[model samples]
Target: METNLADLPVRIFHVLSRELGRDNLWVKIVDFDQDPIFSMKQLEIDNFLKRDNCCDQVLRRWGNRGQTVGDLLRRLQLLSRTYENEFDSIQLQLRRKFKILRWVPDSEEQVTMAVDEETIKLECKAQGFPCPTIKWYTNDSKEPVHTGRSYTVLRCKCSTEHQYKCVATNEIPEGFSFSEHYKRPGKLWNSVLESDFVDITSLVRDDELCESCKNFEMGRLSQILADDEKVENKTIPVPSNLDSTLRAADKVALIMSNCSYVHLPELMTPHCDAQTLADALQKMNYKTVTLADLTLDEMRYFIREYKKLIGDGVYAVFYFVGHGFEVNGQCYLLGVDAPADAHQPQHSLSMDWLLSIFRDKQPALNLFLLDVCRKFIPYDAIGAFVEYSEQFKKFHRAHRNMVYGYSTSGGVGAYEVKGEINGVFMKYLKNHVSMEISVMSMLHGVLKDIENDPKQIH
Candidate 1:
């Protein structure tokens, strides 16, 4: 939180005028320096200051008579020192940027320490005007294992290998915080930059291993196992360089989550998940259209109209959370009205068709997030699902700016705990969407979070 001397005066002046009346500030300035000529205009002295509006005029008057900005700053600092108690309170309330300085073990090095007896100590360092708090977690656990700059891990058997990660954060009055990088420690900074979840060590105790554990490590380095799903609300810093480009583009999001179904099993988290995502996107200035439980025809109708909102530089996002399946390498989203026993394209919306429509609109970014299962259909249903026509096969736009982020890989089922608010994918994604990185890079971070998550690791 090192202050920029150039802007420091303006910030200090703003607080002084609000805490003390304009008349009192003007009188104090004249008496503090005992200058023979008072340059402040009478109109400015009497002006009703609503926030910082009148500060500009007063500063302009102060600068007119052979006085530099630095001169004004020097005068302000003198006043600040004279009223130390009051100035201290005001300075404490002023905003400061938070950032991570360095990690004890740099994640980029990918150092693999093999230990069977010695304990390991891990630490992270950060600095801000108001210091940021540090928290540590093992693997994908939501709750912090330790809170502070450093943590110690005891030696464990091969059965307990795990990765450890640390995060530093501080709140801003403005709900969202800005981001910037620093060259070294103790430099003036910035956000929630995290250490790569790193494997602290690999231990192989041959005598302590079970049959399955023996086969799992088969001469290779021991890998961490298991998934745990607990929800931790964290912020991602949007870097300054990408700020303008992300904010400049027209952003529109269409969120459709179907939980109630006539033929398929009813879900518990879709409604809650959709709302959570909508709130997060809206904070980032996205125009969000959130809908639920749409039928096949309704899905088609809404999508057709949704594309109209996309223009040359628009950033269009389409998200669907519901029952879904893949067959012959093609994916389909199911509707509430889909049949129970026999499901076909007629009762679902084809992904190819969705991509084709968006490709023609020429948006700057086309992002699709599917928070549903992609397991293959039964053999009996395969023939019916593989009805792809020649047109569908030829509709490939490899050069288009499109990204598909699926919750689970093909032939795998995505899970939703009965009482959880969000599915596995959205649980990690909501924390990453606002990051000031490329769309792919943001999604890659989400992927890493998912990989570390104990519940979603499988």
Candidate 2:
């Protein structure tokens, strides 16, 4: 009856007293650390003096051995209830703190002004959001306009010159909206140029050359003599006996661009222009496929299949229209989800890898259309055009059959569209292509037009 719960010997005595009642039950509180005797009389008296209804009823029938068992079961049930309550509270808090919502465009939108130009357009659109207090800014400036609860026209004056973007912000945290850049340049520029020297080794005998064999022989001899003399000298080699007609049968075309993602409206115009070129090629009985429509493996497979179908007389064209970067002196075509980090080289597809695939096919004409220009990097802390012009020059040197076209000269950012067509360069190319324009003429015309435009200094 006076058993201390913390004392093991006393609790044991209480348990034994309940088990055997007064007759056989006996246990004593003993110090195991200092030897002590247990007494039966003490235990019997304790059990008789302090027996409750729950314990006494079971003890009288079952000799009181079940008292400790009833106590342990009740303690465990109380602990389980406490744990359940804590778990429920944690789950409720998580449900209240997080949510997922779809993005919505601003309400009460208006096109305040738009000036149409051949290559671009200048325009403004009024947009209103909840809790007003909106601010506006453009790519041409860092200063923003803050208008309180009033209509604001985001000013953009050059839609044809280049793509323009607008940003709106509010006082509330995480409250902001932006309009996609718009580009209205109706035409795109595609120009291809090669170094003055020719790689005569890569060409077959039937290939055409500007110099004749006799002049080439004389020029080689003059170069050897000039080197011995150490005098400034120039040698003009004669043309080769190669027929231009035979070389025409072995022509191949390669088309490629690196900017493909059309997340912004400014990209639409150029993207459509690229499509127009594809459409033109299709009309001319040439096979064309946009990279967006195929995976890397699929593109490779199609190239192989096309080579098989067209055989030796085939003209192959490859076009690319998306983001590009140069790494370790190598050009890479960035996929839609390409990351900005150069360390993640696995995300990009190498230009050489694509060219190698074509080389395996041994096509006669290799025309490569690269509409990729260095521009504002998507989601990057630093923006710079990873210059790979030297790498391209090396590739051009190695692949004699290749015709390379860049949207701008080396070390220049290519123009992009602000609206419906994704690329400004591709848009112009398509407009001419749709009119049954010849490939060579289209390249020359677009480049000339772009050079003349005062807004663009090429």
Q: Assess each prediction's global lDDT (C-alpha) against the native.
A: 0.62, 0.39
Candidate 1 lDDT tens digits, 1-458: 33332244755656634544434454455442355333444454556354355554544455455444345444544664354223322333343223334433454532233343335566564433334467888886899989876676654343347788778764332322222222235554445657677675553221212334323332211111011111133222333663222232367788888887888898877866787888889898776766667788878877876765565666778899999988877779988899995356677788888877766666788889998888888788776666653367676758467788888889998888655668778889989888888888888988798878877534
In terms of lDDT, the poorest run of 10 residues in model 1 is 221-230
Superposing all C-alpha atoms, what RMSD in Å does each candidate have to the true structure?
A: 23.6, 29.3
Best by lDDT: 1
Candidate 1 segments whose C-alpha is farther than 4 A from its true place: 1-249
Which digits, one per residue and each the tens of the lDDT, describe model 2 over residues 329-364? 445555544544532335556666666555544445
- Distance (Å) between predicted and true CA of 336, model 2? 1.4
